[model samples]
Target: MMLSLFDQFMSPTFLGVPLIVLALTLPWLLFPIPSNRWLNNRFLTLQTWFIYRFVRQLFLPMHRSGHKWAVLLTSLMLFLITLNMLGLLPYSFTPTTQLSLNLGLAAPLWLATVLIGVRGQLVYSLAHLVPEGTPTLLIPVLVIIETISLLIRPLALGVRLTANLTAGHLLIQLISTATFVLVTTMPLVSFFTATLLVLLTILEIAVAMIQAYVFVLLLSLYLQENV
Candidate 1:
């Protein structure tokens, strides 16, 4: 189905936002959260934590890059991920499932890859990508495949997130949409959305965790290839 850009009239100053950035900021800034954070279940790796902290430090200089942009961008990611898990509640939207939002998330990551990818000698970077010790004959073929795959990383990032989020939302949306229709006709079906919401909520939490892992892993992989 062709997804609609339902809110063409709205201006999202930060990213493909459903609401204004500052509007949501005060609450999170004011409220406290667990320091070890994931609205979803994930494998907690010290490696991932260090890498994330390192990347955040790397971006510190970019504070000149517009504070609003930084805050908005970061918050956009949080909102998406939070909402993805929010199906844990009945009738909440999955913002990431929406193309506008996923595109926003993917674009900056793609740009970051390109910027870093070309920072060093392109030829040297390309050479390192192939790794060490390969069959001489197979090396050329492997290089060709890796080159294509590397070029498509951004597209993969976008498609991966969009597909996963969309599939889950679509499934849950049907359940939700059905609940409303069924409720009018039958009392038994009235409780259906409730039960489905509970089950889907757990699944949604899993999806949220997986998507975050996929996003970060691919992001790290891109940087690893370049640096």
Candidate 2:
């Protein structure tokens, strides 16, 4: 029986239970726990520095009101980066590659930011649906358009993350399969393909990290608008 290229994406199960739960939980264990001692090891120091810098840059433009989300956003960045990077490993399933999971993460956070804007500054929030200096005839049309755009934010977030990771993984798998097949009949060509595959894998690793940052960064931008 031939397996589909996409079979790699199927959620793994054992005894009828989804292994995604384990996949999701396992990454968290890899992070070093902070120790009680005042001094920290190099790894812990580096982790702390990265988090501090990321949080600072992410919220720099927003008012102090947005600062409250620093921890949530920072934690999300780490969670997503971990998931994305780990998925590159052989035989591992990536939960974030699922649109359902991505939407589940995006929708609630996007809605919360919208709700905060509505509750804290209802007039301002509603004002965003219509632009300043619009002609009278275009006001209603512009409002509807803006409202649709606002509603699509979460969908865009989910789709962007899902699509990028899916494409990268699919490409990697296709190239790898080709490399293995060519090794038997075309050793010379297979050598070059293998080299390309190695480079591609390195690129995928970078993409995984960047896509995670982009996801979190966009969320912070949405929060900035509200707060």
Candidate 3:
């Protein structure tokens, strides 16, 4: 397991700093504000809707200043997501497929839940975790359930993102390798397998976007519940 961490850095840097920086700075460097805005409007039409929704979120009601946080979070999501999807393009690495990487993203969400709720009220977040209308004798049981639920958030995030990306990539890699072997011996096998792998690669790209959308939307919902 420790060696896997080292292996992660062997081909690509484990933290995805290069990819992330590229995504972050690309908007400023290559495509400056006007051009970036035009591209966002043209390519990502629905993202504007999300920005509006994030602003006008009824349950949470983030302030104008707080809107920047949503932009930052959403930017991070799209950045990582684009990088993840790019991995399907041969000789690339999917950073989000890593548990350590996903966990890094999840840890801040966990802390945000704690910090936001704590700022509002020390026990405010616990309100949802606790049973107000339940039997008093079940308090310990309820507390345990709450603890488990809180702990599960990060675990769920890590597993959900990592599993989807890793499985999809592994399937492609495995099938492609087998296809090459078959082609060398039988010649007829590679044609269909290679075609299928290409189709599956496209599907994997869609799944990458879906996973990113799911993670971000879930976090938005969580933020709504807390704030």
CA lDDT of every candidate:
0.59, 0.92, 0.69
Query: Count of backbone clashes for each model?
Result: 0, 0, 0
Model 1 lDDT per residue over 32-139, tens place: 333555542343355346446745753454433322244444444455555556534542434455556556777787677567657755776767557688888888
Q: Where does candidate 3 clash, by residue pair?
A: none
| Clashing residue pairs found in predicted model 1 | none
List the candidate numbers ranked by lDDT, top first: 2, 3, 1
| TM-score for each predicted model, relative to the true structure | 0.56, 0.97, 0.74
Better of 2 and 3 by lDDT: 2
C-alpha lDDT of candidate 1 relative to the true structure: 0.59
lDDT top scorer: 2
Q: Candidate 3, residues 128-224: lDDT per residue as tens digits?
A: 7786897888988998998899778877988898888877877886778779899988778788899898899889888988888777766766666
Model 1 misplacement above 4 A: 1-80, 86-93, 121-123, 128-144, 180-194
Instruction: Kindly provide the TM-score of model 3 when superposed on the true structure, using C-alpha atoms.
Output: 0.74
- Top TM-score model: 2
TM-score, candidate 1, is 0.56
